[model samples]
Target: MTDAVRATPAARLRGIGHEFMEFFRDLTQRSPARFAILIYLSLILVFTGLFSLPFAAEDGRVTPFADAFFTAVSTICVTGLATVDMATHWSPFGHVLVFIGVQIGALGVLTLASILGLVISRRLGLRAKLIAAGDTNPLRTHGGPVNEGQTVQLGQIGGLLATVALSTLVIEAIIAVLLYPGLLIAGVEWHVALWEAPYYAAMSFTNTGFTPNPEGLVPFEHNYYFLTILMAGVFLGSIGFPVIYALRQHLFSVRKWSLHVKLTLITTIALFFAGGVVFLILEYDNLLTLGTQDAWDTTFQAFFLSAMTRSGGFAILDVGELNGSSLLVGCMLMFVGGGSASTAGGIKVTTLAVIALAVWSEAKGRQSNQVFGRRIPSDVLRVALSVVAWGATIVALSTIVITQLTKADLGRVLFDVISGFATVGLSTGLTAELPDPGIYVMAITIIMGRVGTVTLAAAVAASSRSQLYSLPVERPIVG
Candidate 1:
């Protein structure tokens, strides 16, 4: 009987090995973004599985499985929406899991994995280069013979990743150090102040916005220096890394800025100021700000902080206290999100810029789209349109579903749905009140946002094809 049982186990092991090998083979040929999502999902599963153990929550108390899974997904996606409060509910072990997940999500799973592989093998191949190019949205390659070697240099990859990580750490560290004095003056213990400072720094820069303290920044809300540091970190994180790199390069040579770099910087600045002004105008009498006696100071702080709230989740005032119009505006900014190739999520400012430029050209009766005196390629416009269309569809569907499930106001439900899809993590206090199914929907949206709507749509729509014939073009209609 023992021998027969052992044989059965051996057969099962052989079957598992074969299945694993086949899966690995298929994944290697898949899109790198898909593979990256798989890696992130697997990590989340593992972390959640471990947290399922009794020792994972606070006070060694067993947490509900749903909460653990939800928390895992939230952290891995870098969406700060929590079904439960982090400060009171999660143990230190769970907090560590959240921290690790946020770091990986912010840096990107594939980028981190590629870095590890490069360190181990000390080489990157042509396939890897193509994947990296796709991930970064570089200009399409001219049709030419491909070389297995000399396509992408590992040094460039390492340099960019290292630069982003180092820049984030240095900026966050400075903010943490600067914040310590304010925290200490607020009567917080030195040790608690030190710990919370870095925690806030990491949360703010990663745009996770998960605060260690229950009151959030409300305690230091009136402190100008504290708000300044937090806002700076938030703004930097929302700007795309490629833009930052380009700006850094141009700083050394003022006349050599790339068109894309120039457009991104201008759009980002314009959006920030515009959003700030609109927020000031709308919320001038709302309880979160103007209801207080220091209306001018409150208005200025609200406007500036509202701009940061688009991508980063730090809120100076209570989000629930905003009026309907203010919430609507906030939702719009969150849906538009920050720049591409950065910690921020959404359709990206570049995509919005491209679409806007395309619209302007069409209205002018131009056959070709142009931006900043440079022709915008059709392929780039197609990508931009696809991202916006797909993102809108997702947000719309999720909003409908959540509205049905939660019976919340249509505007607030749509706002939360877009917030999730953009990975903006700002809620009008609806996240905690969401039902289980609603939480799952938001979780899926977060994953889609981080992976990118266009990438996800492309993965689903991908097919093998050979172009054999060209169709004749015909004009359809006039506006």
Candidate 2:
């Protein structure tokens, strides 16, 4: 009887091992979402390890595990809330790890993984292609079968990814080289200046807002060239990859631009300019900018920097130095966030556009939504509403939780919460002082922002392919 029991257990163990292997094989073949999660987790682990090393700390001493883990999480999520001052705590090696994490996180786990798969396999499978399409929200593939045009368009997505990466690198390289001389002129040593230039370049373009210097640009506050490069990088990075790709295609084929592209471009330009003007007007006499010697230059700088602060997290002037009204405006901008499918987060420009269109339609008594001379699809509108609703819910919950946890003022708490949800990293100097519970709340917000509101909603929604039945159509009272 004992021998029979032992044999049965051994057989079960073998069977389980075989099933596990099959599961792994199937995952490699068909699971893009799972693959994305794994890639992100792996990168986070690597960052955590590197940051735990003694050289990664700014004091040239080994950092605590919690601090390192939190920093790695913040970097990987591209949420720039730092527990410790990056410049003063981390060495060169540590800074590089943070930079690499920011780049990878901003590109996204699925995108980078898909690129790798395409490179290694030389072609994407149908499952992979479908996942890619869903993630990017490409237009519906038409006709009874796939065509060359669809394939070309899909290929262009890859090309666009490469273009964005290359553009970012080249721009940063130029800025680094340009800034090196400026830093040297500012009395920085050649070695320190050279190291910091590239560091700033990487941080600025990625919108990670991590400064290699502890003072956080106070010394370069008046340097036009430095500010210009930083602002340019931030703006380019905030614009979505799809918009950039569309712009490139439009340059080649002027008449074939999509409405999505048109809407994104218009909204982005309007928001940027409008936000700049708002900041200029509100902060004109504030100590942050008005205290400067050059009035016009200060105004211009304030406007440009305010635009950057919305999604980039790089505060050229001290955020703490801003007055109450300026901080309120900054919080609003941060909450609205940047474009869809971009490194920057929030409810997304598309969501905002859809909401605006919905409001316009209601005001006009229109039965259908229209924008850019085309009717918006019902499914698109549903997704947009869901994203906005869920995003607001999460942010509100986070604000409440963080307020309770930290006992901070409601405005400051709300600002930090929105900043985390948008991944904007602009703080009212409250991030580091938050208790452990507050940190966790921010961490969750960071994850949600980076993973995306829609993605998270989908994950929580039904995953089954089959639907039971459709409910009877009924109009609910919504105002």
Candidate 3:
């Protein structure tokens, strides 16, 4: 007490600073994934506060922190779920803020931090590297050591970050250029088209369904060229960064691509066909969907719906009118989502593929799960199963909460809940009507899904327990 009383204010400030540093040091060394989660949470809070300011809304009124927080979460998650109208409710400043937020969220906060670190020191310290490594590569969690060869490969972190940024810029630019004429043709003035092109491109390339046009993508539904261009943007954006980077280095040389890249492409393509076929069959005779359209139009619309189900979230038709069978397909596609390290959110296609291959191998009583002529790592299989379990638990729990809160039908509630948890933003006209509790529940789900269910669970379950001895093995009876 005597020493504390004698301490000056300056000394006390220094003591607090040192303590803060120590806290962060321990966190980074002990649980890098938790550190990354903290980084993302900090960004979300900053953005939420900014969105709550007076000028964020068009009316110059201080936007309610709840709505603002929802928007901030949605934007930072790149989820495209909105309670307020994006075009009419937001001022240009707000729009710009959201644009910046989406871009930041697309690359992830830790990724941007890593790039900034590279700029500052030209080399990340071990702690910073651990944070960046865990965020970018799921296989390299802080609970375990990374492979030696992979650690050397991380020496090119700077280059990989640059490639990710450059690839996003180039893809968005191309898509924007291609979409400009469509906006003009859709009756937008030249000046409006100029801004709208980039907006659409950003939303599309990020697999977000936020359209600048009030009527949404419906106006261009019949314009095959416009829809096709959007489809292209969505597909490229959801393909994941590692696959894109591999393509940049290897081009058309499939032999040079990584096994993960190969698996992503194959799974993505197969799901595209499977999803489209399901939609085609379910919506064939339904007038609200493809019933009135000719075969050509039906085929294109079905394909577009299939793409949207893969987390693109852009819908040409009202999803609420679809049959129960079509909704089932939608849920499956949304849950299985796009590739890992992608802007698109879900359990990830790789996770689904690994689980499926593991099941197939077990069915045939094989020694190990094999894919692309390589055996899947045992740890990867464990992670895959863990992801599915976490994803299912969240979806089930969120669905129950949402249904209880909103009293919405189970079908629509399931659809919205999955959409929220997958960050897919496709809704059956129910999002805006949700009560405050419902909105908050969805906000949590979007954050959970965007941060990743498995990643979030891992951070929660983080431990330093390294067993020195193995437990006795036991086998349980199977079906």
The prediction achieving the highest lDDT against the true structure is: 3
Deviation (Å) of 90 in candidate 3: 1.3
Model 3, range 203-273, lDDT digits (tens) per residue? 87788778876788878888788888888888887888767877787878877666577778899989998
**Alpha carbon deviation, residue 391, candidate 2 (Å):** 1.4
Name the regions of candidate 3 deviating beyond 4 angstroms. Answer: 1-30, 109-152
lDDT string, candidate 2, 1-479, tens digits? 67656678779888898897665455534665565666666777788888998877766788876677778878997878887788778877887888888878777655765775665456666666665654554333211233233223555556766766776678679768877877877678998987888877777766778887778877877676777777777776777666666666565664566656666667777887877787777777776555654777767776766666557887766677776787788777787777766767787776788879988998999998886566766667777877878888888999888888888888888877888888887888888887776777787787777777765654454353767899899999976
Task: Assess candidate 1 and give its lDDT.
Answer: 0.72
Model 1 agreement with the true structure over 36-125: per-residue lDDT tens digits: 666778877887786676767777877777777878877777777788888777777777777777877777545654554454335544
User: Hey, what RMSD does candidate 1 come out at?
Assistant: 4.3
Instruction: Kindly give the number of clashing pairs for every candidate.
Output: 0, 4, 0
Reference-based TM-score of each model: 0.88, 0.86, 0.91
Task: Give candidate 3's whole-model lDDT.
Answer: 0.81
Question: In angstroms, how far off is 325's CA in candidate 2?
Answer: 2.7
RMSD of 2: 4.3
